[model samples]
Target: MLDASSNRINGSIPLKMGEQGNLNYLNLSNNVMSGIIPNDITLLPNLRLLDLSSNSFHGAVPVTKYSFSPLEIIDLSRNYLNGGIPVEICFIVTLTTLDLSNNSIGGQIPYCLDNLIKLTSLNLAYNNLNGQIPLSLVSLLEMNLLNNSLVAQVPDKYRYCFPAKAFVGNKKLCGNIKGLRHCDLPFFSIIMPLVPMSICIGASLFLYSKRFDQIEGPGIQLLCAFLPR
Candidate 1:
């Protein structure tokens, strides 16, 4: 039972938090915490609810061997945390709710997220994450991935689950999402008109090139052959 919520606990979570093997509820939310969550926090074998949301922590979420197994609810939302979300958190395999919204986190959604076999809710909205939505997330009951930089088409497999608004603010994004603009490209823009003109000029020159060649060539040969004769 560790409650450091809504305080001025700036800087990283102290490494010693790991030694508390009996800690079940750890809430450090609504604080000024910064830096990576200590690698040692995972030592809390009994931790169930780890809430570190609404803070200023940066770097990847650290998960040790012990800390990741028993986690049920984790809220790390509304922070400045950046980098790819840890696959180890997905390894918990029993997460009911995981919130990571409103951050600067970037990179493609992890491929192993399907490992969250029991995840019910996942929030990753309003980040700088780019790349395609992972196909593995089809198992999720509800997911929020809006307002990111996700580009590319959402596969048809996930169309029934997520809507077009789930992928907003991504300029390069495309797919079957409704109301999203289809990527339009002018065919003539890439087809250079001058190339055909050049080909025609080349062909005309090739057919009539012998006339110019006759005028330019053999003058020295003619002079030498005639003079010697």
Candidate 2:
């Protein structure tokens, strides 16, 4: 275990950091570090918890297939990183908590969240991530998805378990939440009203023709005009 957080550590993480094969825990949060997060650090096989939050790290996270890391808790929040979350992150099946909040990462949340069967907590708030929340993620116990461009209906099962705050900043999101409006169905709204109105009008014309069936010349002409040619 190594705790070097709250220090003045600057520049990129040394590539040799991966050489520490047996180190299990590392915390470099609340530092003055800047640069792309070293991919080498992810090569650590036995590391369990990594906290590099509250730094100046930028660019995309270097998560890749080569990362044989068995990390269970990964925190890279409160940084300046950008780009879509790498799909390879799902390969880290041992992950239990993932915090990528307060960055500028864009693109949809990954759809393969079921691959992370052990993930219980997720925080992707305050980013530029867009698209529907993956159905696989609804199974999580704790999550914070505030302030993104996500679009999806919150399932009834998760409404009370996860509150309005989890989905507040997203305008396109809707369900039975406190802050979000109900999902609008423009298809039904515009089409349903026309259906009943047309039926009523047709019924009225048929009844009027029946009333004047016995009347002669002028009445017959008027009723014909009301009917289709």
CA lDDT, candidate 1, residue 67? 51
lDDT of 2 by residue, 30-147 (tens): 9999888888777898999999999999999878878879989999999999999999899899999999999999999999878999999999999999988887787899999999
Give candidate 1 regions above 4 Å deviation.
7-12, 64-67, 183-229
Q: Write the per-residue lDDT of candidate 1 for residues 161-221, one digit (tens) a residue.
A: 8776776677666666675656533332233232343233223221112212223322233
The collision pairs in model 2 are none
TM-score of each: 0.72, 0.82
Candidate 2 ranges beyond 4 A from true positions: 193-229
TM-score of 2: 0.82
Weakest lDDT window of 10 consecutive positions for candidate 2? 204-213
How many steric overlaps are in each model, in order?
1, 0
Question: Which whole-number lDDT from 0 to 100 does residue 189 have in model 2?
Answer: 32
